[model samples]
Target: MNTRVNETERKRIAAAISVWENEGGAPGQDSMHHQYGRRIEADHSWTIYHVFTGVPARFGGDAMTGLSRMDATSGMLRLNLRNAERRRERIELSSFRAVPELAECGS
Candidate 1:
């Protein structure tokens, strides 16, 4: 069952993930959306993890259009660092902006 998702759908799914994160997850319960993604070395990009499985999708980089399509099975996707540390500080998934670590480079 290989379902082909277009760029629009990928962005839509990404938006859903964003919304799920912004709402602070499910009511009266803690949501693990924080583990959804982290800001990569690039600006405005992130390696977004699967909403339920926490697996990394091909979608990453260039927040606007880099999101990859979703397949029916996870085997078709790629795996990234499950727990990427952010300059010794935990990255808040809700904010996909560049991490403070990058700021140090310019200083």
Candidate 2:
């Protein structure tokens, strides 16, 4: 029930959203793997997830140091980051309630 949202975290979420929108819908399973691998190649500091169709997972930089996965059917995105300090700024599911369009595939 923590409602606190920081500016940096907001910006990061916005960036991730933009990336998801501009990249054309939630990635397919293979595309998701390739995208994550490419992103790791470009910047190993961040991780990616698509827990609900087109909704991209937004992790705190520190909260994404290790491994993660998005279970679309269960709407659960699990993260196993090594740093506790970085995991404090998670984007809750409530934040996405208003953006239902993100859950649909784009043409």
Candidate 3:
């Protein structure tokens, strides 16, 4: 990927990690009780990938609020956002094979 895209993905991953680390506690800790309010669980490996490549990604049950990478390769990272209801369940890249479709012209 391009340098600019990679850099942006790196920043996104860094921000996500910062949120996760700053929250403190293990991966499934009760972030709500903490000072930060809610802790965003981040995958270390995935974060690293995003830092290197600018691949966009969205994992976890609640796709709306899941973590996203900036590039395609970064999406290969194995950090799962996980589902809110199903705490044990993790959203993997393989599961999301359908890419978004482009808008049609003058529909």
Candidate 4:
């Protein structure tokens, strides 16, 4: 089944979890881990996944493009940072163990 919603509508859902705080929306929060996934085109898309609820949400992306005059929302899946090291345990590379700190403050 293909779940689809207008991008504008999807943005409203994304705005809730969006890192960027808006006028009236839930501010972003620190997560044990992040989740990501994308569905077929013309379908509901979300990058954030709630493990407990079993529902996913979009991470949201750049509002606009300067060159193309186009708007882009985040569709790319993000690996959850929580237990990130454990996830990389299988890999031998030491660099994968490093997790970047969030530089932004949530409202």
Highest lDDT scorer: 1
Best by TM-score: 3
> Where does model 1 exceed 4 Å of error?
1-5, 28-107
What's the TM-score of every candidate structure?
0.22, 0.22, 0.26, 0.19
For candidate 2, write residues 1-107 as lDDT tens digits. 24456777888999997656433345454333222211231432334433334334544533333332222211222232222223333344444444678544321
- Is 1 or 2 the stronger prediction by lDDT? 1
Which candidate do you rate higher for TM-score, 2 or 3? 3
Give the CA lDDT, 0 to 100, for residue 36 in model 3.
17
Error of 1 at 100 (Å): 56
Q: Compared with the true structure, what per-residue lDDT tens digits does model 3 show for residues 1-107?
A: 99999999999999887656433324356432222112233542222222223332334532222333332223322242322323333233323333333223223
Give the whole-model CA lDDT for all candidates, comma-separated: 0.40, 0.38, 0.37, 0.35
Tens-digit per-residue lDDT, 27-85, candidate 4: 24634333332222233322233435534443344321121101122322123442345
Which parts of model 4 are misplaced by more than 4 Å? 1-37, 40-47, 58-77, 81-107
Clashing pairs in 2: none
Residues 1-107, model 1: lDDT tens digits: 23456777888999988665432244332233234432222443334545556555444542222333232122222222233344224555323346566555546
| Cα lDDT over the full model 4 | 0.35
lDDT of candidate 3 at residue 67, scale 0 to 100: 30
Model 3 per-residue lDDT at 89:
33
As a TM-score, model 1 comes out at 0.22
